[model samples]
Target: MTVSTDPGEAATAAPPVNGNAPGRGHRGPVWLALTLALGLLLGIGVGLVIPQFLKPGDTSPEAGFLRDMSTHHAQAVEMSMIAHSASTTPEIISLSSDIALTQHAQIGYMQAWLRDWNLSPTSSQEPMAWMPDAEGSIVNGLMPGMATPEQMTALRAMTGKPLDVEFLTLMRQHHLGGIHMAQEILKLSDDKNVTWLAGTMVTAQQGEINLIDMLLKKLQTA
Candidate 1:
C-alpha cells in the first residue's frame, strides 16, 4: 500500500550543542499542539482514502480487522506521542518515537485497506465478534488494548521518568492485549491479506515487547 506520513511529524534530531546557547525549555504546549495537529491531519488523510478500499461486500473480515485495528493503533500512537515529549529516559523516548512512526504508517495502511474493501471505517456489530475467543478481553464492552478515557487522560498528564515508566507499563499491557487479538485474526480470518496483517502484528509487537521489557529494566536500574 502507498502509505505516506504527514511531513510535519518527521523528526529533527539535535546534534550535540556547542554548550553556548542555553537549552530551550521544553514547552509542553508547543509539543502537544504540534502532536495534535499532526494526528488530526493524518487522520483526515486516512479518512479520505478509506472509502476507496471498500467493495460491495457488507462486512468482510478485512474490513472488520482494518476498522478495529485502526482504532487500536490510534491509542498506541497517541500514548507513544505523549511519551515522546514527556518521557525522561532516552531509551523510552526512542522507543516511543519508533512506535509513533510505526503505528502511524500502519494506520495509514489499514485505512487504505478499508477503502479497498469497500467498507466504512466505522462498524456496527459488537467489537471482536469476528473472533468469539476475543470476548474474554473486553473492557467496558470495547475490544482489548483500548485505553480507558481516564487512562488516556492520565497518560497525557505525566512527565519525566514517571511518564516513561508508566508509558512502558501501560503500553506493554496494550501490546499483550493486541497480541491476543492478532492471534485470533490469524486463526479466524480467511482473507489472506488480513491473516498476513495479523501475523505481521504478532511478529512486530512481540519484538517490541521484548524491547520494552529491556527498557523497563534499564529504567529501573537508572
Candidate 2:
C-alpha cells in the first residue's frame, strides 16, 4: 500500500479531545506486555556481561545501527503514545499500545548494547552513514519515515476517526522505513545477537504493516 510521503491530508484540522478518549481503553493482550517487560530486563542483564567477550567499536555498523535505530524507535514510541491516549477505536488503541510497549523494550535492548560497547548513545557520524551509499537519505537530520514537526503537531491536535486514520497511515510508513534499516543491518552485521534482533524487527514490523494496511482500509472505507 502506498501513502503520501508528507501525509498532508492527515495533518488537516480535526476535532480535539481533552487528553484521552473518555470511555476507551486498551484491549491488547496482557501476556504480551509481561513478556516484553521480562525480555527487557533479561536483555539489560546480559548486556552488562557481553562486553567482556566481544564489543563493537564506535564506528562499527553494529554500533551505528544500534544508535540510529534507538533514535528511530523513540519516535515510533512517541507517535504511538499520542495515538494510544486519544484514539477511541479498540483496534487502534490496542495496536498503538503494542507498538509503544514493544518498541520501548527494543530501545532498552539497543541502548544496553551500546553501553556494553562503551560507546555513546549519540553519534558524531551522519545517520545511516554505516550503510553503503546512503547519502541523501537523511532529510534535514530526520531519518527515513520519521514525521516532520508540523505533521506531529497536526497529529496532536486531531481526534476521532481522523486521528485513527492518520496514526495508522503514519505508522505504516514508519514501519516500512524501520524494516528497511533492520533488513540492511541483517545483511551488514555478522554479530549473532545484532543480526538476531534485526531479523526479529524485520519479521515483526512486516507483520504489523500487514495489520496496519487492513486497519487503514477498514477506517478509510468506514
Candidate 3:
C-alpha cells in the first residue's frame, strides 16, 4: 500500500506547526458553534427533504440502520477532523473538511431519527444485527472499516506527510466498509429517506475514495 513518491520531493515543505499563537482562544468556541449549527441544519434538512418516508418503529431495520450508521459516520468525522488539523497537504485538508462536514450532518440526521422514534441511541441487540449477512464483515470484533484503538492513536500522534498518507489509507478502507453497510441497508429497508441517505453515502464515499487514491498517487510521486 506504499505510494511511490520520493521523500525528497517534499523539500520545500513547511515544518508542521506545534503550538497555537496568541489570541486564538475564542476560535475554538466559534468553530464548535459553527460545526454544531451545520449539523443541526443538515439533520433537519434530511427530515424535511423527505417527510413522506415511512417512520420505522423502534426495533425495525430502519432504526437499526440509523443507529449503526450514526456510529460509523461518527468515526469518519473524527478521522477527518484529525486530518484537517494535522495534515499539511492542501488536498488532504480540503478532502478532510468535506468529509467532516458531510458526515457530521448525517450524524445529526440519524440522531434526530432516533429522537423522533422515541428510541434509545443504542439497540438491545448487537450492532449490525439488522444485516445478518454483514456479521462476517466485522474486523477486530468491530464493524467493517472501523480503525482500531491503535490506528486511531497513531493517526492522532502523526503529522505532515505521514499523517496525510495514513489518513488517506484509513479513510479509504473506512469508506469501503461504509459503502458495504449502506448498500446492505438499501437492500434491507425501503424507507425513502433511509434509502436516499444510504445511496448518497455510497455515491459520496466512493467519490471520496477516488479522490484519496489520486492524492495517494500524487504523494507517492512527490
lDDT of 3 by residue, 1-222 (tens): 564466655533433345543444548889989999999999999987665455687778889889988988899999999999988788999999999999999888889878886788898878788886766877677788999989999999999889999999999999999999999889888778889999999999999998999999999999
Local distance difference test, each candidate: 0.79, 0.88, 0.87
Which prediction has more favorable TM-score, 2 or 3?
2
- Stretches of candidate 2 exceeding 4 Å from the true structure: 1-53
| Over 4 Å off, model 1 | 1-56
Query: Residue 180 deviation, candidate 1, in Å?
Result: 1.0
lDDT of 2 by residue, 1-222 (tens): 665566555444332355434443353457678889999999998897676556788888999999899999999999999999999999999999999999999999999988877789998899998988778678777887888889899999999999999999899989988998898888898999899899999999999999999999998799
- Find the candidate with the highest TM-score and give its number: 2
RMSD of each: 25.9, 30.5, 28.7
Score every model by TM-score: 0.71, 0.76, 0.74
Question: What would the per-residue lDDT of candidate 1 be over residues 16-132, giving only the tens digit for each residue?
Answer: 345332454457569889999999999999898774553425465556667788888889999999998887677888989998898888888888777766567888866776666
Q: Residue 32: error of model 3 in Å? A: 61
- The numbered model that scores best in lDDT is 2
Q: What local lDDT score does residue 120 receive in model 3, on the 0 to 100 scale?
A: 86
